[model samples]
Target: MTTLLAARSDRPVQFLWGTNVLVEEAALQDIVRDDVRLPEAGPTCEDLAPARFVTNPAALEEVFLAGMNAVARMDGAPPITSVVVRIQGWREGHGIPAAAESSPYVGWCCLFATPAPSTAESGCLSLADPRAGSDLTAMPGLPWGRQVLIRPVPGALAIAPGWLTHSVVPIEHGQQLVMAVATCSR
Candidate 1:
């Protein structure tokens, strides 16, 4: 069954979450840790995309398509075949420092490729209230204060609209391993 997660029932943004354990959790962790090992100044979106990742294509595809389908269900959109999926992991100091933003996708899926830290500051995904609505504003001001926090659970999945003003709180404790899959569809 699908469950809706929102700060307010009237909110325009829809966040859905559930569990999906990978068959080989260790493989996902190895791929991400290797990518983030003593490298770039900060993690970029491209770093998370699947092209740069070294994991089984089937595993990625299985999760990606399942995620897109869930996105379609939430937004009442059509699920088109052939959507690009990307994923990356951000350890402490590698996650988004500040600012919540959106991307160009119907929606996306985020799951723990590896176990996440217990501390909430371990780069958890924080999002503004969806009641802010999805539209360009005359004045660019986000309701950052009205936010909801999603602490990634191992083998769990959270899906939300790309338009939601969301950011990863900087990882302060252990590493937070996340696998994100996005698909751009009109």
Candidate 2:
């Protein structure tokens, strides 16, 4: 029989059965907005929020513990682990690139899907591989965990191996609010 693990929330985003993992969005968002420190990037100043914040220290601790629990189930994977709540908006090539080598941990990209803007041009989320020796033009198909592309519905989650290279398309001048927590390690 398949055993299902319990999550912090009962929302559909918490379900763990897809190309990308999911986490409850509302609660997760509240926790992040109440705790973390969002910074700005120098380059595009768009790679990330370019600016944002994380809330709820206690909740963050819980996320870390949960991450550790996931690592423990990996059998022989490394012990290092981390949990983070990330926020970003529309940008040409956003997000971290995939790794060139293999890692011993996993990553969960919990997309907080809110209401879609009036138009697709308003905001969009896209992902790609980097370590495969690829630039924006030379990138190949979304690597392994990078198969599914989501438009993020507030309260939706997207979790996958941490090594997966992902990015957000661009927000133009509209509002595309998305928050994700990635649990990963070396």
Candidate 3:
């Protein structure tokens, strides 16, 4: 029998997941429209949204900070150094495939898989088993055997360690929007 332990760190992976209405739809729309223009491409998701980046919209910063605090508490307080923000979009045919990898930052905040009011299918997040070998950590965009797709709630924030390999599942229908925040500590 494949026994699964419910202990926090002993599990295949560990992450902070919560739902809070922190940002508004209108605000989110504006952020995407007026604020997403980056001088250059963001960190590779393919370091992240710059290795350290935040939302141009102040309203979204509060939401990101809240997530940072939660992840910080889980980890004994570390001095945060930088933050980066970016918006990721997905449609029926185009989506980022999963891989076995982790981030280079101290923590990351992502509002993954936003709902498509016009569609019924929900996109899911496939996270690799934390217990897997380190080889998996560097090879992102490639799928592994042990991973799971998690459905995300709009307005809910997912704050997790920088080293957990995760990716968005192929969106079968409609569009999926995401607000990504990456942070570093020194």
lDDT for predicted candidate 2 compared with the true structure: 0.41
Candidate 1: 10-residue stretch with minimal lDDT:
18-27
- Write down the lDDT that model 1 would get: 0.48
- State the lDDT of candidate 2 residue by residue for 106-145, as single tens digits: 3333333334555663333343444343233222443333
- The best candidate in terms of TM-score: 1
How much lDDT does each candidate structure score?
A: 0.48, 0.41, 0.43
Models sorted by TM-score, best on top = 1, 3, 2
Query: Model 3, 1-186: lDDT tens per residue?
Result: 022335666556433222111222222443333332223322323322522233344556555555565566645666444454554544455445544324433222344443443433345554554443333334332223445444544444455555555566555544444445445444
Position 96, candidate 3: lDDT: 58
C-alpha root-mean-square deviation, candidate 3 = 9.6
Quote the lDDT for 102 in model 2. 43
| Higher-scoring candidate on lDDT, 1 or 3 | 1
Error of 2 at 125 (Å): 3.8
- Native-to-model Cα distance after best TM-score fit, residue 158 in candidate 3, in Å: 0.8
How far in Å is the alpha carbon of 27 misplaced in model 1? 13
Better of 1 and 3 by TM-score: 1
